[model samples]
Target: MRGVVLHAPGDVRVDHREDPTIIEPTDALLHVSATCVCGSDLWPYRGIETVDGPSPMGHEYVGVVEAVGDEVTTISPGQFVVGSFFASDNCCANCRAGYQSACRHRVPMGSLGTQAEWVRVPLADGTLVPTPRVPPDDLVPSLLAASDVLGTGWFGALAAHAGPGRTVVVVGDGAVGLLAVLAARQLGAERIVAMSRHEPRQRLATEFGATDIVTERGDEGVARIRELTDGLGAHSVVEAVGTQESMMQAIRSTRPGGHVGYVGVAHGVTLPGEELFYSHVHLHGGPAPVRRFLPQLIDLILDRVIDPGRVFDLTLPLDEAAEGYRAMDERRAIKALLVP
Candidate 1:
């Protein structure tokens, strides 16, 4: 089989690799139909996250079940499914509490790689969510987004306590951030402010339900958020970029008692103790428990309540994944969907 491999920083290739098989009774093998590049993947491609030699890339995926281990139940061959980066046992204590991302028996699916013609998925019964039936080709991209970005953004909205009569601020314009704007609207927030500088992203954010677009950065961005909220700051803020500036901007943009749901993959971020301690803002977020929301998100996509797939402005064959990575790294594409 052919799969994407990152040999080093800025070097990605689709190379021949051994095919996957069920190594555990809880595992299932998927004939991948669609997969895509993630913002997190750029961390390694840009050398910010070390690439230990050639590493298999891609995690966001949707596919058809080709086979399942003996222990697997509720999932069978011929079913179409979507799964996230982390596979978890839905019965675990954390999973039961709705934090499947932190499930005691969690498995990082990236270790198995989904950017290929086939991939192995563990915790099949708990990790993968089947669609109502085999969906049409046109629905694949949206279903694939639910596997990661859509769920992540929804988690961001929930974490920030976005709901009726509240003003929400989203502090990133990437796919996840853009979708966070979408999530805020669906959650019933009275106002949605999307922080973005790019005109194309600004337009998409507006389309996603952002009532205001703040193109400023740093303190200026926070000021704009404050101005829009009548100097009290926003009622809630979603920090979708995991940098020092973005995080602080989120914190500073929220009212004293508001919340900040941070979903960006944190890299070298540190908080000033005194500042954070006095901010009086509620902070919540981590790798999203995507499995917890997969069922609902899948339903929404199928029902056409949301269209998160619009974030994928570029699509490529699995063999051209290197260009997909390059396009995202250079900001030429919001997100790139890879067809296997």
Candidate 2:
């Protein structure tokens, strides 16, 4: 099989690799139908996250089950499924509490490399969510999105406490951020503010139910949000970018008693204890427990109630994944879909 391997910064290649097989009774082998490049994948590609060697890349995936271990009963071979970036034994205490991302037996799927013809999924019965029916070709992208970005965005909205009569602000205009805007609307946020300077993203934000767009950055951006909210700041703020500036902007743009849901992979970020003490804003975020929301998100996509797949502005064959990475790094694409 062929898979993406990150040899170094700006060096992604499709190389031959050994195929995957079920090594554990709880594991399942999948014939990956669709996979994509994630914003987080750029961390290693850009050297923000150090690479010690050629590492396997990609996590988001939707595929058909080709085989399952003896212990995996619920998910049978031939079923189409979507799974989270983090695989979990959904029966764990944390999973029971709706935090599958922190399950006792959690495993990062990226390490298994889903960007290939086939991949192995651990905790198969508890981690993979089967679709109602075999999804059509057109729905593959949307189902694939649910595997990660859509679920993450939904988690962001939930963490931020977005609901009716509340004003919500979303920082970062990437795919996850845009989907966060969509999630906020679906969660009943009365007003959605998306901070973005790019026209394409701003347009998608509006289409996704953004009531306003703020193109400013740093303090100015916070001021704009404050001005729009009558100096009280937003009722909830979603921080989709993990940068120090974006995090500060999210904290500053929320009211004293509001909540901030940060989903961006934090890199070189440090929050001053004193500042946080005075801000009085609630902050909570980490890798999204996507498995917790996979069922609902999958239903939404299957019902055609939401079209989050619009986040993928570029598509490429699995062999051309390097170009997909370049497109995203160069800001020429919001997200890239890789068809295997």
Candidate 3:
């Protein structure tokens, strides 16, 4: 098998790697049909996140099950499936409480790498969700999106309490952020504001249901949200960039009783305890428990209710995974889909 390996920052390569096999009775092996380079992958690629020697890359994946261990029941060989970054035992306490990302037996799939021809998924019954049948070619990307970004965006909207009559603001214009707009719309938010300077992203945001676009950042970004909301700020704000500036802007852009759902992987972010205590804003977010919403998100995609796959502006063959990373890092692509 071949997969992506990050030898160091700025040095990602597609190299021959050992094929994955079932090591646990609950595990399953999958023939990866589609995979992607996520915004989070940029962290280590840019050196902001440390790269300690060689490391496997990629997490979002949609595939066909080739084999399953004895313990795997719900998912079977030859079924098309979607799985997120975390392999969790969905029967755990946290999973039962709708936080499968924090399941007691969760495993981060990135360490195993999905940017390969084959992938080994653990806790198969709980981690993999099968589609009703093998979807057509056009629906593959959308199903792939459901593996991560779409699910994360759905979690973001739900956490922010987006609903009928609510005014929602989304910070960041990446795939997740743009899809947050889509998610907010699906959740019935009355108004959706997308903060983005990039024209392509702005256009996609609008197409995804954004009622307005704010291009400013930092304090100016917060001011724009206020101006649009009649100085009261939005009823809910979704932060998709993991930066101190983006985080603060999100908090300041929400009204006193509004909610902020931050899904960005925070990098060196810190908050002033006193300011937070006085803000009267509610904050809730972390690694999105994508598995929790995979089933519903899959149905939405299959029903043609949402076209989240439109976020993938670039597609490349599996061997060109490095170029996919480069395009995403250079902002030349909204999201890159790699075909294995």
Candidate 4:
């Protein structure tokens, strides 16, 4: 099998690798049908996140089950499935409380490398969600999106408490951020503000239900959000970028009593205790519990009520995985889909 390996910053490659096989009775093997580069993948590619060695890359995936361990009964071979980056038992206390990402037996899937012909999924019954049937070729992308970005975006909206009669602001314009805008709209936010300077992203934001676009950065960006909210700031703010500046912008753009839901992978961020103490804004975010929302999101996509797949502006064969990384790092593509 061939898979993506990050040798160093700006040095991603597609190379031959040993094929995956079931190692645990609770595991399942999947023949990956579609996978994609994630915004978070750039962290290692750009050296923002250090890599000690040539490590396997990619997490978001949608595939057909090729085999399953004896313990895996809920899912079977030949079923199409979508799952989160973190594999969970789904029966843990945290999972029961709707936080599968933090399940007691959680296993990070990036190390398993889904951007390949096949990969092993641990705790298969709890981690993988089978689609009603094999989705059509056209619906594959949307189902792939639900594997990560769409579910993460939905978690962002839920964390921010987006709902009818509330003004919501999204602080990033990446795929997840754009999907967050969509999630906010579906959650019934009366107004959705998307902060982005790129014309392409701004256009997509509007198409995804953004009522306003703010191009400013830092303090100016917060001011624009407040101005549009009649000087009270937005009722809820979704921080999709995990940088210090984006986090501050999200915090500052929400009203004192409002909520700030941050989903960006924080790199070198530090929130001053005093500032947060007086800000009075509620903060909630981490690895999104994507499994918690997979069932509902899958239903929405299958019903054609939403089109989150539109976020993928570029597509490439799995062998051209390096180009996929470059396109995203250069901002030439919002998201890149990889077919194996």
Top candidate on lDDT is: 2
What TM-score would you give candidate 2 relative to the actual structure? 0.99
lDDT of 1 by residue, 147-181 (tens): 99999999999999999999999999999999999
The whole-model lDDT of each prediction reads 0.93, 0.95, 0.94, 0.94
Clashing pairs in 1: none
Tens-place lDDT per residue, model 2, 204-239, is 999999999999989999999999999999999999
Give the per-residue lDDT of model 3 (tens digit) for 1-340.
9999999898999999999999999999999999999999999999999978999899999999999999888999999999989999999899999999999999999999999999999999999999989999999999998888988888888889999999999998999999999999999999999999999999999999999988899999998889988999899999999999999999999999899999989999999889888888999999999999998888998999999999999999999999999999999999999998
C-alpha lDDT (0 to 100) for residue 9 of candidate 1: 94
For model 1 the local lDDT of residue 161 reads 98
Candidate 4 Cα outliers beyond 4 Å, as residue runs: none
lDDT tens per residue, model 4, 51-113: 889999999999999999999989999999999999999998999999999999999999888
If ranked by lDDT, best first, what sequence of candidates would result?
2, 4, 3, 1
TM-score of 1: 0.99
TM accuracy, model 3: 0.99
TM per model? 0.99, 0.99, 0.99, 0.99
lDDT of 4: 0.94
Instruction: Quote the positional error of residue 122 for candidate 3 in Å.
Output: 0.3
